[model samples]
Target: MLTKYPTPKKLAHANLSKLTEILWNSSNGRFGEWKAQELKNLAHDSFGVENCEDIYSMALLTMLDEIQSLAEKADELEKKISSLLKNFDSTITSVPGIGPILDACILSEIGDVTRFRSADKLAAYIGVDPSVNQSGEYTSDHTRLPLPAKSRLDGLCCCCAA
Candidate 1:
C-alpha cells in the first residue's frame, strides 16, 4: 500500500523502522485490535479456528517459545565466546583497545596476521581499505570495496584506537 520507492539503504531502514513500529504498536490500542483481527482471519482461513481467543493464546505462546529458544541459543553462543576469549586472552591482551574477546575474534577470523605483505594489503584483505581510482595521473580515494578481509582490518583498527 506504500507508494514510496526506497533505495537500498532507505529500504533497509524503512523495514527496520516498520518492525520497530509494529512491535511498539502491538503493545496497545487499534494496532493490537488490527493484529488480533488479522491473526483471527488467517487462523480461521488456514486452521479452521472458529474461536479467535484460542488462536490468539496459541500465537502468543508460540511467540514466547520462539523468544525462549532464541535466548537459549544466544546464551550458548555467549558461553562459547567466553571460553574462546579465555583461551586467547593472554595473547591478545597486549594489543591496545582490544581485550580477550576482541583479540579472540580477530585471531580466529584473521588466522595469521603476519602472512599479510603490507598494512594496505592487510587492510584490503580485511575489507576496510578505502578504494582508490588510478586513471592516468589522476588518483583519488574511492568507495570501499566488498571483501571478507575488511573485518580483520576493522578489528585491527579497533585494537590500535584503544
Candidate 2:
C-alpha cells in the first residue's frame, strides 16, 4: 500500500544534515560530535549573545547539531530501552500482543509508562485506538486517526522498527 518509500529516507537525511549544521555552528565546532551536556550550556549562552552575526551563525549551527544529536540519542535510547524492557516484569511485557522490543519503543517515547493513568490513554496516545462516535441511540466506529501528539506518532514508528 505504501508508494513513497524513498521520500522518508531522503527527508530524514536532509533533516539530519540541517540539524548537524545548526549544532556545528552553535558550538563553533568546539563541541565536535559528542555534546549532550554541552548543548545545555550552549542553550544557556544563547540568551546572552550580543552580536547579530555571531547569533545568526550560532542559531543556524545549533539547529543542525540538535538534529544530529537527537537522532543519535534516540537510537541509543531505543537500544537501552529494549534491554531494560526485556528485564521488566509486567503485563505490558507479558501480554500476548506485546514484545520486549515493542515495549521498549513505547517506553522510550512515552518517557514513563506509569505516567499513563489508563490503558485507553496509552492506546490513544500511540494512535492505535479506534475512534468511536455516539449520538442519541446511534453509535459509530471509525478508523484509526492520527495521534494528536507528534511524539506519540514517533513512538509508534519506533515500535514498528522493533
Candidate 3:
C-alpha cells in the first residue's frame, strides 16, 4: 500500500475499511471479510507509532528497494554460477545431496585429488579427517574433526561421514 499512501503516517491514518477494501480488491476477493478483520487486528496490535514522518518513510522505502535489488543480483549471480558449473564433470554433481554450489565449493577447494597421496591425506587437507588421541592403553573415539577456515565446508565432513 506504499504506492497509495507513500508514508507510514499516511498508512497509519488510513481508514480501516478502505485498507481492507484495497486488500480484498487486490487479492481478487481471495481476502474476504475474515481476512480483512485479521489484518485490521494485526494493524491495531502492531502499529504503535502515532506519527511517522514522510522523510523517514522515504528512507525506509529506499532501504527496502536497495535490499530487493541486492537480493535480485545475488539470485542472478547464483544462476550464472550454476550454469557455469553444469559444464564441468557431472561426477561431482552425481554424488547424493551435492548440488551445483556444493560441487563448485569442493572443486574449488580441492583442485586436484591426485596431488594427495591417499584419500586420507585428501580428507585431512579438507579438515574432514577425524582427530586421534591415545594415552597408555586408552584411546579416544576420535569423533571430532577440526573445522575448516571456510565455514561453508565445515558441514562437508559431517555429510561425508554420514
lDDT of each: 0.57, 0.57, 0.71
Clashing pairs in 3: none
lDDT of 3 by residue, 1-162 (tens): 556655544655667788778888989988866765665555546653445566677777788889889999988887888999877764776777776667777888778767999988877777778877878999887567776655555666456446
RMSD of each: 12.6, 15.9, 5.2
Q: After superposition on all CA atoms, how large is the RMSD of candidate 1? A: 12.6
* Model 2 score (lDDT): 0.57
User: By TM-score, who's the top model here?
Assistant: 3
Tens-digit lDDT track of model 2 for 1-162: 011111222223333344455567767776544453344344444443344645555565677678879999988887787676656544556555566656665556666667889988877777666777779998876555655465756656555656
By TM-score, rank the candidates, best first: 3, 1, 2
Window of ten residues with lowest summed lDDT in model 2:
1-10
Model 1's lDDT to the true fold?
A: 0.57
Poorest stretch of ten by lDDT in candidate 1: 1-10
Model 1 alpha-carbon miss at residue 94, Å: 11
Give the alpha carbon lDDT tens digit for every residue of 1-162 in model 1.
012211222223344445445645656544543454454344344533335645555566677779879999988886787776664424656755665556666677777778898988766777767777688998875665665555555656656576
What is the Å distance of residue 124 in model 1 from its true position?
Answer: 1.6
